[model samples]
Target: MSYDKEVGLRMNWPMIVYISLVHIVACYSIYNTITRPHYMLTYVWTIILWFISGFGITAGAHRLWSHRSYKARYPLRVLLMIFNSIANQGSVIHWVRDHRLHHLYSDTDKDPHDSQRGFFYSHVGWLLVRKPKRVLDAGRKISLNDLYKDNILLIQHRLCPWWNMLWCFIFPAIVGYYLWDESILNGILLPGVFRYCFVLHATWCVNSVVHQWGPKPYDNKSHTTENGIVAFIALGEGWHNYHHTFDWDYVTAEMGAIKQYNPTKVFIDIMYYLGLAYNLRRAYPKGWEHLKSRNIRKLGGEYHVVEGIYGIPPFCHRTVTYVQGEGGGGGRLLSETQVDNMSTTDEEGL
Candidate 1:
């Protein structure tokens, strides 16, 4: 069934035993490292997990499955699915259900991860506690037409939670035994414990900080807002405000086109461009231009005026006014070509 009432199972004992053993091994390894002090190796392992889990969450579960930003080839999808499972947030089906509900109800009492409940509540409390009745009601009503049909995603949904125990914890313990120079702590602590914990909070910040604090570019009433600080840590997801305003557009800064480091979009675009993926939906040039204007205004710039824009409807306004510097000054009205070129220049600078 696509939708059903969420049921509670007394926490799975087998899963608990498996996770605890992994933790014990990892802690032992960390203790070993305290005596050996292989800080460099620990750092290296941390970087590896950071990149893998970061991509797994962003390119795999998020843009790929949750947003359907682009399509991936089977091989890449399989690899990404494995890493996402290791990230151990939850099954894609569950994550998407909660995420789709967030978009539908947004900041209302129905939002599964609403920031109105406080930062910690939004970040992790919702996951730890029984879901609210309103959220369960919304989940039962949510449509899964897009997700239910994809065989690959369905496979991911089925295997991700199990992998959470094996790949996320057990594999790290095994890897520590083999390559961590007789130091299980280095392997388990750096890549296993730390990686899992870090990725969890990074993903959760989108529902928490991105909404509670940041600049609102498009629709101010939307509780979601853009947070650059959060994005840097969360792998370019900080542009939450832009994302909510135009969820259909693949990239955060309008159709996967960002002037700076949007590694998430970059990875997806590469896969799509290289024939490993396809059907990437981007905002029209005019839509992107409007976003730029709104961004400038939101970032304290003033007087964004664009004239004779072709694709934009005649009645559609194409300008923004905001404070720039100590004294506000006006810049030239930018055309689609101008905006593209300017963005290119900014990217080059980056």
Candidate 2:
């Protein structure tokens, strides 16, 4: 009966049609690349561009802005802004607001992509259908005041439609037409449409595949899980159980998983070494082992994780050490107030 419960599915036909058309064209583009051997360069570019766009979401929107998992210098922030435009999922402010809401409310009716609504609903149906009243009401409580103050996010939010069209599709097509001597049509199909669609689905998997499969080691009582395959495809975000348990950790996955399939972690690490990123946070004060699958969350209660600049829930359960800079194993621990101020200062990066 729970599975059969109707949560209202008024269809947003335009969105449904657009998504369907994108998938069909993406499939055709894959076939086109195979048959047209000359499209080798375009194919390679598609893969490279996919990761570039994903960085915008995973690093720019999710980690840096949404969760405040780390802080980035102006140069890196600008670069990530450009990358997020290429990803074209949404503006950083909108994306972060939705993400924060998803975390605070999780799989309840308030969650935009509620996993209990079924895989298709979580994966894409939420977008294809008009949002229910509950979802809208839940979203209203989640504010974007912090995000709006950031000039970088504000500009991106204003021009996302125009710039996204340019970077996500038109620019890539132009490169194929001029640099690669590929047809504009093939360019749009291969790297433009196909890659855009590919990134969308892969990110969506975190909402669907991640919630359904894998182990819930950190908080067994929670709805999320850890899936290595999703992590690999998503550039390391698929450790949903760990992430939900320790949402403030900049690594998102396990502490010492740089060698694993978590390129997003490595990308942030590279930026840290280059002095482009700093003030990265770590797991909850007690780390994963202490949770021991305990229900660390209670509805509308304070989350028991480290607080970041962007979204610190009402309460934290303990006063233990939360590593900074490196993975959870080593690094100086900052008091809560220090962590909040670190993002704005010119302090030497770790």
Candidate 3:
């Protein structure tokens, strides 16, 4: 078969329907939970799994693994890996490779889920098309030697499907067997299938709603935008503009001042402080300054252009640049001397 012919066949609707039925089943389970109120335990399990899946996608799959924003220790990586599998998303290898391609060729044909392809494509239509060559070619471009060498990520990748089945289905069914003994709806539907579907759609929103609508606090041309509501639903992942611009910055704690986008940031901080992760990165003060809005809505002071050693104005309000590196200020606002000191610290840290 010709390559073009193969590409045409790749976007098969029947294939898509077959593959996505699992998700449909899961969604139906969530729907049925309303009727089966006796099994409240399943509801709690569903919410907990839903939350864990967000952490797996945002912190584990997207941030740590895909973007290489920070270094995680073995224990945390392993725990996140298990959650990731339970989320029933694609394996880390596929997730990272596809994501790297998205970054490198955002909003273009090369992007796996370019919004320009249309909303449905961005949401899940891209998955309907088999792009084995594209996936492989893209994977080759983004070398994940670090992850390959990491024993934890490797093991997780290997056992992902099985782990997904066990935790998301088998384990839940086991609990139901012990309790209900006869209700498939109680065990499998409420907790297992339903919870998985709820989590899947929530995570998929990052790919869909985030790209389609939101404030462009940073770079809008890239298709990623910042939305506070999306962030609330996506566990802080809706701060897409900040993420795309400063992909390596560990703290997506706040997008400007208005939206409190920090669930993922808090999760990262906990992992870092506990030594489960390291090398937490922050947006440069100047770069961050550019993204901040200059308005009354901005609670922080408006940015000022202070001439510095190079005569270039510092970008942020916190910056107090001076010719001779001499000035005075206190608190979050920096004095010239403090700016110089901080610049030196930044250089040394690098």
The deviation in Å at residue 9 for candidate 3 is 4.3
Model 2, runs deviating above 4 Å: 1-9, 284-286, 292-350
**Candidate 3 lDDT, tens digit per residue, 70-188?**
88887898888877877777687778888888888777666777777688878878778766465457657887776788786687678867766777776766776786563665677
Clashing pairs in 1: 29-184, 29-185, 30-185, 231-238, 251-256, 300-323, 301-322, 302-322, 303-321
Error of 3 at 38 (Å): 3.1
Ranking by TM-score: 2, 3, 1
Tens-digit lDDT track of model 1 for 1-350:
12244466234456456545655655665676567666465667666777777888887777777788777788888778777778777776777788888888887778887777788778866665666666788899988887787676688677766756577756765665677553664566667776676777788888889889865545556777766667777778877766786776666553233433467777777777788888886765766566666555433354444333112221112223333344335534433333333443343212
Ranking by lDDT: 2, 1, 3
Tell me the TM-score of each prediction against the true structure.
0.73, 0.79, 0.74
Error of 3 at 350 (Å): 21
Per-residue lDDT of candidate 2, residues 1-350 (tens digit)? 12334456699998889789989988998898777755578878888998999999998899999899999998999999989999988798888878999999888888899998899999998999887877788888998888888898888889868878789888888988888798888888889999999899889999999889875545555778767778777888887777897888988865445333677888999999999999989885467544522222211111234433211221111232334433544545544333333343332321
Give me candidate 1's TM-score against the actual structure: 0.73
Q: Candidate 1 overall Cα lDDT vs. reference?
A: 0.66
